[model samples]
Target: MRIGSAASLDELFDLVLEAAHEAVGYESASLMTVDPAGDALTVRASRPGRLVGTRVPVGPSISWQTLERREPIIIEGPADKALGTTYTKDVPFSICLPMMVAAKTHGVLNVNRTAHPGSDVPLFLRILADQAAFAIERMELYGDLQHFTGQLLSQDEEHRRRLARDLHDGLAPILVSAHAQLQSAGVENEQVDKATALLRRAIRETREILGTVRPATLDDLGLVAAISAAAREMATESGWTLEEALDDPGPLSREAESTLYRVAVEALNNVKKHAAAHEVRLALLKNEDTLEIDVADDGHGFETEQWGEAGVRPGHFGLLGMRERVAFLGGLCKVQSKPGEGTTVRIVVPRDRLR
Candidate 1:
């Protein structure tokens, strides 16, 4: 009953196993959680604590059957005759209940007792398993919420840094030169002209900063044209060969356009900063219901294994932002690279999701 107040999955598992052993009198019990890949379930907590972290394939196991049916099952007689499995056959009575969250079976809770249990055992155990399922689902949603909040905070800090750099490098010098010219009492026509030119450069720099915040071209020319112009700009600035093949996917929602544009910008910036490549390629293609933006470079690649759990490199904060942006649009972002080879980043979103 107190399982609802558990703080983490580990704590919940421990509480559930203990409750089942003490209150339910199951004698032995275990809780297993499905892996993210959905291929296997690992024992998260067991009464004996010996089978913790033990993973078993889901193929043809009673746990798999329970998951498939999305219900609880009971077995009588010997373990081999009851469950048809060599593993854990010594236990005479067994019951397995699927842990469900919003119609999805996330895992299974298994209990074993010596004698044949009545119907009340399964019912009582199912109630406890439901509590555990709700706790796990809540924890998963809370974790996702925390991750997105962190992503937003990271983006806010990055934006501040970019603005600071823009002012220091571009506009500050122009203002200093203008101030110096004004301080001189004997200012000539040439001095006035020079000051005027510096003022114009300052205006241009400010406009560039605004553009960096949110490109006016994205709203004016649309996603495809905006991406093409950005690609050309990057190639000109870096002096790298640029290849582009953009298929007009028609008009997308403003959110989709912005997300795709930002992802492309991040990819191109990475190429400029990290990739010492002589050539780069960008392509936007629409196939059926999917729209894909692909960027590839000939630069020296990195080890793909360095990517963390979310498919973004640990120190590459920009890539993480790109992934978060794509995910918000209900899309997938993939980055692949291998040492001595090259690197490619792809962003794929569904057409319907864009709308």
Candidate 2:
């Protein structure tokens, strides 16, 4: 709140990133500015060496809730991603923090992650966002603002989902048929073994597609079972060791269950992407009344303090999305990381908050 007016735009952007990075341990950080046209936001600054100078349209974004309502909108997760979910029309997983100075809507500030930022980051984001809004609003430039990293991220995700689906629907069957043909053929020598290996590879690709498309089995079975399958799949694919400890999970509210699954999905994605450790530990437990999950890795941890302001890594929406999703559920998410020590994400939901 005490950031001086004399501070340069570069310095203010630094403060924004520092606030966001310090709030949550994101390997990447960004603060986007809405454009004057009320149509797009550009990533003016992002982590060092990151390609974040990207911009996207906000004319059709749901985060426009800030512009429409003139306030902030907090989102929980992708539970609302059902094909026809209203309010989520063409936009998913974006939380908007409005910027208003002198009673004019100069622009908006957007912060996001490729993976889910924990619920822990929002409060800090909300605060630092206000500071950044003031700084950005104060920047003495003409068409001064970049708007929607939310849109870019959402679109990218939509593409990933679509690509994953295409891989499943467009190519998975062909691979399956090939596997069947190889099995029924009379080739029983080294050729058969090679065919068998090819079939295994194809099946693995299909599983990867399914994982990307939001694991179907997750919806059929409960979160615990689905996440266990994901962990095992990760281990099998990467040869990394995984340790799982889950108790008997009772029937959670549909929303609660969904939140758990999505958060776990983000956590596992992080483990796969950043956690270089060969061994991972996942634990889900009901501590009498609270629902808690801990995903930890003995990998090279990230330095929370080094991230710059303006924009996060071009594609890193994990932490930002997670934070928004958990906040919607009234749950709490925390991340602790240390270089070489490891990184751990703890998500805790109070029983009373379950819906």
Candidate 3:
């Protein structure tokens, strides 16, 4: 609590990191902040002789997993292969917790010890982390309010512009031509058939546009139904096999449902636009604690190190948007890819956010 009351974030982090080491009695500790583009986490502070100011891709580490899942993780005994290879430490225990506020994770707090921390240690650290997270969130919320609003407005406008352009250039002409054909000397059977086909095509296009804007099925049926509907269409268009394994997801707040739906749409769009795979699988699972959405594709992947870096291809705005949307709901989004392997985008939002 004392650390959280600092006047500035730098002061707060310095005190918080110190508390993680001294008060928590960890041999080593570090603090990292998520990058603005949401592709990387940069070490902001660490114990002596450890890497500071180092930026790494968000994966294969407990800290990243905590950030990706927005939950606290404690590992005992030998670490899993993914966790063992992440950082060069001979420690026997580690604790990672997400610094979250209002569903958004601002950063991660990581601590390591040579042996298991006592029962009280975990509770103490958890309480400390929560307090610290709340403080940082309060600071960030006040600091970034204007900037966040501006970003939201800008993205919304861009989305509106795209929709307007599609309607004006694509759908309007079809509808107008159909109307003209109907008004012309269309007493002949051939003219009538042509007019009917044009009108049908126009109606389909209109529905497609509306679906993209806001799927009617989402409100009428629910998220699973809406996702299945969109995925089926994508599969037919791309000639890729789409598999689904959706458990009973139950109900969610409108914002949560819409955000998840948008993320699924973006993931599938990426598969269609970039992945040359023949198969894709999407799964939605509801467990006791959280809801997870996974989109996996068997397509050629790209190097994670090179992602969002300079000289990369330009069309990653979809990914940026997906991350932002998920983060807004206090969720974590992770994209994993390898060169000849495939890519998987997983989003995990806590069930507490559900209505």
Give the winner by TM-score: 1
Scored by lDDT, model 3 comes in at 0.75
Q: What does candidate 2's lDDT look like per residue over 115-189, in tens digits?
A: 464565566666666666656654653112111222223456556566567666876677777777777776889
Q: Which residue pairs show collisions in model 1?
A: none
Instruction: Mark the regions of model 1 whose C-alpha exceeds 4 Å error after superposition.
Output: 79-84, 157-355
Write the residue-wise lDDT of candidate 1 on 1-355 in tens digits: 8897888889999999887887668767889999999999999999878999999887878888789889887876544555556555567788999999768787999998886678777888888888889889868866774564444335764564565466547755665555555645466688466655545444444433333355567768888889889889989988989999999987787768877888898898888888887899999999899999999999988886766566654223467677877888889889888876779999999899887
lDDT per prediction? Answer: 0.78, 0.64, 0.75
- The most accurate candidate by lDDT is 1
Model 3 TM-score (2 dp): 0.41
Error of 2 at 11 (Å): 40
Error of 1 at 105 (Å): 0.9
TM-score: the better of candidates 2 and 3: 3
